[model samples]
Target: MDGLMPPPARPRPAFTDEELRTLVRPDRVHRSLYTDPGIFDLEMERLFGRAWIFVGHASQVPNPHDYITTRIGREPVIMTRDAKGAIHVLSNRCAHRGVSVCATDSGNTRHFKCPYHGWTYRSDGTLASLPQRRSYPHDRAEIESWMSLARAARVDEYRGFVFASLTEEGPDLETYLNGIRHSIDDLVDRAPDGEVAFVGGCSRYIIRANWKLQIDNGVDLHHATYTHVSTLDDDGRQFSRHGGGPRIMVDGKKSIDWEPFGVVGFPYGHGYQGRPPVETLPSGPVYEEYVRRLEARHGVDRTRQILNYDRFNSVIWPSMTFQAFGQHIRVVRPISVDRTEINVFPVALKGAPEAYNTGAIRSLAATHSAASMIQTDDIEVFERAQAGLQSGAHDWVLFAGHPGSEEPWHEGGWRGQGTSEFVSRIQYAENWISFLCGGNGNERG
Candidate 1:
């Protein structure tokens, strides 16, 4: 009676780390990873909770009092630049009634006041006042804690990009980026002054598929050869028939029957496809003008490196997608197990000619926008993949497409053909497994 055996320990969790390990295999992944509602909630806790999630770029809130509302996992938050030019990410909920403190899509505001109650907070999220303060007990420490907006555990900026962590500890932004940072650097470096700016507006589309499918497909070129084949014009069709459309290659080798693309993979599922031959991009009225500016600022050789250097799609695992070639960026937001929202932002190179920026914008319009000639068809394929995955006809989605390559690490991380399962496999190994197990990122495949 004294010990009572403590009735054994109660298992607080409904699932365990062992169960999540079962969701992945060497060359295949279980379908539940795409369709399970419970798993989605767990990911919100584990994946988004611990990772350094991309909140917004510094340009989004450039001026004092400028702010934009967004979410980290399911937590509603606001990213605001204060009068002193420091950026802060504060929970959007009012401390009193749990109502949104600021409700417009985005704008400049000196302070936030809850509509439900009179609680007010400064731009830095410090509580200014609340109605009838005399009615409450004056415990200074307790009141200070309650009045202040809850902030993210950690916030850091890299190259004007801002990221926040819900958990207190993790690698800083630079470490999380690793090889993938080069893709972002190159994107802004292509600008004549070594900088780029968002064009102030973005196109958004609702994708009816899992968010993972969209990110994986962002770095995937094989699907474009099939899914967007219909959008090809007569000349475009001819080019496709000869295997000369959009492509991802490494070491000049991208043949289905041949060795796969030479790509780079890094920790946290971030990587880039082979650099495209941007030098061969069709010359235009503005092409010569853009080249002159680049050469003027960076010299001929550096400009050549910039022009010929092409990264088709640089994927930042979980959601963000960067494309150096298109001068466009994508942020994928997961709404549910089957729904994802993709925001596409068109960017411009600073100190470059007007014609150059306009051409890149036009190129994006024709191929990547909502009104894009090809994406409508591609969206259908994404939905179809979702429908098929939900059928449960196959327990695993196969990534076994690479021809013949070594299974071990290549150049520090696992890498192989453009279609190699190694990319996804290592993502699961280095990032997913460690994330699911709540480890310190030391776990390896």
Candidate 2:
């Protein structure tokens, strides 16, 4: 939970009703939100500063002294496992002369020693040692207090995924996750052992577009058929020219309708686009036996709910999106006004047959890897959009694919037609609310 203290009230620039309306036109968003450095700074301060952004999974640092360094908004932080087996999210900076404590991406370390000043901190972030004890006796307390790596305001875990809030006051992670909690559950539940762990290596890419562009792209199902045409072309012998051939079947029934992939938009800017089932999944006695075992363990209805749930990709607000069934998570980090860093993590389903986990990994690489043919093209499109927006030719981008087509709001959130941009709309709505209400509004459902 965020516990940030409120700043004294100042005469801030009131984003008037007209400006808010103009910024989030049903069909388009204002260009300033994407291209303005001032707006980008405010977003980092307001949105990322207050939201529960996913840092890394706890399994990534399973060992007692294992640690992983990552960004929480613009701040560099480390997720380290203490000797007592608890994880702490602390600033990577050293108290003595503000140098980074850990330089490598990740590894097992007994303690973090500042390369600059030889100050050391235990993996749990307490000051362990200083080079000279007698240098300043009375200042030892001040030095030690400063030497302890600054921890995050709050750190929490959902399933095994770790999230840290930069601020000191806000809703708990569960309250923020709302309807999207099911996505994480569905991912872990698919594992025969009811657990999932990061696998393979992470893929990192730099995109020359605003971070929101990447978020919008995740829920845009219609682009796949066009932008990823090369992937479909490569598999033309099996899939039809339009990227549709036959429905993948499981248990003598069609698994997904290729024509319509649904989208579900929840409060707090979380949402997902349903992914069509893979037609290439090997079917036969092996598949049947696996299904039978699952049915026996979870019952017919529960097993059906697990396997037949339509969503393929889910976006957790502000940052982090993953293809649950595909076993991959993407962390989006805003580098600047028009620059972003995206990290992709492949996951292995624990207790599932090795073959099944391998299949999921292969599928993730084929579709979402940094060097993926499909993903490369998608990045190019985003870059082109960024380039075009800079030319002053367009002032807004439309998100009104399904205007007047909102689904009845339910306990699970709003459902929409497969091709709709309602997910993006919902995200921007929450984004505006977060910026306007200072992280305390009742915008979360």
Candidate 3:
């Protein structure tokens, strides 16, 4: 009697179209959207499964046979460079029995051999060999075709940033990027060589909150006044390792007029905040030399435009965010309903002075790294939000700040005041629901 197996657990019913639509409204979102595991699973399927997700920078796999393993939603993937210099995003799972073939983060490996059965695949995702090949009745080509690592349905790059889609249909990478490509240009244009490399190894941290919480805070401007008040000096200026940044005082002390700086939101939940007016611009010999090199390639006027620190954190929603001026990239990886892992990679401008790149890497240590002041503060708030949303005390999470204050922005997006929540509102109202309703969720794009 003790050996009796328990009845199989019942599967939760899927959300209907109306239910999904109701979860996200124009001004607010239902609390259950954050606390429900079913919603997260659907997001991994509908949103990430169909949207163009960021894979990795092409610079990460520049050399032939170079491969880096990352995730596309819940699926493990390997971004590799073949002998022909073609980049491919291959599924990390082995074809036979679905064991992961690559375990390390990155390396130059010609073949990924499965540890379980010794089945190997080329960098291009072609099957190379397998143990006991003679046991199979099929010919070599058939076996190869069946057992090779599956490649992503589509892969493309924009300004060296690689993006992959699991489904073959939908818009191309360029079409999907919309105006966000300009933000990438802002980063690469600063590079004297017209290229940027993801240098210093990634700094990773886990947050006990829904992945959206991290992204929601990306373009948020008002949070700094209260949430990051601890990092501010007595004068209310936010201090980093290098020096002071914008001031964020909770009290009615001296504060920057952020509304004029502006925050813009684009299609597909992409957005960026205009760079807050800093206390001081980058100066000194290194910065001068950096500007001189930039001017030499492009004329003085062009260099000045390129060097203008206009955008702050450019968010490629649901996957990545980065700062062109700050010289770092943040890749968001969702682990589960209430867990997310963020990887911060410092960017090095190719052909720039070594000291400039090193300073960029060091600067991230004080702002975006795992132990950084700004990031830790944000993570705590995210966890607290997650804990609060778990209860049934509230039915909706508000995003109604500064309503009707937005203006038409470049490339058909909306620009709101610095303190507005328009970005998150559009994300939930338009894009999020479109995906959960089984569409591309790219009407605006």
TM-score of each: 0.88, 0.86, 0.95
Superposed on all Cα atoms, the candidates' RMSDs to the truth, in angstroms, are: 6.2, 5.1, 5.1
Candidate 2's TM-score reads 0.86
Query: How would the candidate models be sorted by TM-score, starting from the highest?
Result: 3, 1, 2
Candidate 1 per-residue C-alpha lDDT over 54-90 given as tens digits, one digit per residue, 9 for 90 to 100: 8887878879999988887777889999889999988
lDDT of 2 by residue, 285-345 (tens): 5456656767777888887787764677789877998877667889999998899999998
Error of 1 at 406 (Å): 6.3
- TM-score, candidate 1, is 0.88
Candidate 2 runs further than 4 Å off: 1-22, 25-27, 137-144, 234-260, 277-296, 299-301, 409-411, 440-445
Residue-wise lDDT of candidate 3 within 90-128, one digit each (tens)?
988888898999999999999999999999999999888
Task: Locate the minimum summed-lDDT window of 10 residues in model 3.
Answer: 1-10
The total number of steric clashes, by the backbone 3 Å criterion, in model 3 comes to 0
User: Which regions of candidate 1 are displaced past 4 Å?
Assistant: 1-14, 236-260, 276-282, 403-414, 440-442
